[model samples]
Target: MQYSTKTKFFNKTLSVFMTVLSPVILLTSVQAKEQIPLSETRCLQKSGYQPAHKFSPEIREVTIGNQLFDSIFSLGVKNFSEYKAYIVCRIPVNKQSHNTEFRVKFGIKDDANYETAKKTKVTFFLDGQAVESQILQIGQIATQNLEVSKNNNISIEVTCTQKLYTLDYCPAVEFVEASFF
Candidate 1:
């Protein structure tokens, strides 16, 4: 059977378009599943101190009194190909308060928002190891950065000195953002 010129041209163009589109679609699908092991992982632990929460209502908040004030947020990170999680927080001290002493911890969650073995490499900069097996505190609000991986729940435990009676004491924590590139 003989075909019209217009029909032949249309079929040729459609075939060409499909050929190009198929590869692009396939490539995209393959790329999406490609998992590259992160080499230079600053803090790409499978899990942090707690299972990462999916959502955090208050991205940032300040706690009052000398107590363990915490805000939980879960990052729905099933698995990562590359990149690390960091809890970059800022602590502020009230003028009258003695350099506030506090310890910040991050971990992965179990059934509840509890700590698990799949925690990230714990790095403490503010305090030292003496009081608790995994606890440290420095009486100061020195801007600090803590690293974690996988799913992590973060909290800051503080103990303000009584001397700072006139000063307002609180731990200011802020989850800046995450990067996988």
Candidate 2:
């Protein structure tokens, strides 16, 4: 069989386009099935103590977080060792699920305010909507599983109170684990 010159050129262009499109489609599928690590995403903005990657005193960093948690990276509020801190983490749609659960566990790993132990409250928000809030004490850890379906400009905000009892005893707020699966 013989083809016209126009038909021949059209066939070649379509072939090249398909080749380019194949990799992109495959990559997207692979990434969608994977877990999204909140710690790795880190904090986008914070009510400044430092960068929100400051792990608490009890946290030890390794390729994977130590004996207790499976952290992809060490993530805590402000590396400044603040007694009180607020941090925000955002996940671009490419990194989030259109429908899935955000699972997390954290607490006031700070020993700084052990003496006064004033009322400590932690609130979590998903896209500016309060999903969970808890009144916690030092050494208390809280866990949450939030159902998220947002596919655009998604974000997680962590707000807490960590009144310092002593000048030198400031501990950063820490999250042992946070992931979307």
Candidate 3:
């Protein structure tokens, strides 16, 4: 049977509509954006003496799910008696969350194994107090400073509320210039 003009026109219109719609859908899908994790771009630097004899500790990173508690690769000690051992931690924004807290434990090690630490000469300060500070327990990029007496050697333990991330690495502790009497 021969088709009517009205029916033929309707079919043609529908075909053209679908042809145009399909390409728009495909093009829009191809232009979709991707989601990526937060990142940082900066470096922190500091210098100090230990004891002249170098003590390198094999530091390890601890992870709890996607979050990392410690971001240490290694800790070094030199000129042990000249100055106090201090841990200067720089938390980059890309590696931290807002309004979250993290805990950092400081310890002094006499051996490379980090089995026993001299806890007597160790003290933690947050902002400016002798007690364990809670500033790092939450999420926010900050620099936390903890000081320890220059024992033989030592390392700082860092932990955070969210997954620990790294932007850069630097010395954990430094010593002041000593005068030979």
lDDT of 3 by residue, 7-123 (tens): 999999999999989999898666533221111112122223433333233345533223344433323323233323444332222222231232333222222222122112333
Task: Point to the candidate with the largest lDDT.
Answer: 2
lDDT tens digits, residues 1-181, model 1?
A: 9999999999999999999899988876554322211121222222224544333234333232222333333222211212223332223322333223433323322222211112222233222222222211221122333332222233323222122223232122222222221
Report lDDT per candidate.
0.31, 0.53, 0.32
TM-score, cand. 1: 0.25
Candidate maximizing TM-score = 2
Candidate 1, position 127, lDDT: 28
- TM-scores across all candidates? 0.25, 0.51, 0.26
Clashes of 3: 17
What lDDT, from 0 to 1, does candidate 2 have? 0.53
Question: Alpha-carbon error at 175 in model 1, in Å?
Answer: 11
> What ranking emerges by TM-score with the best candidate at the front?
2, 3, 1
How many residue pairs clash per model?
20, 1, 17
Q: To one decimal, what is the Cα RMSD in angstroms of model 2 from the true structure?
A: 9.1
For model 1 the local lDDT of residue 145 reads 38
The clash tally of candidate 1 reads 20
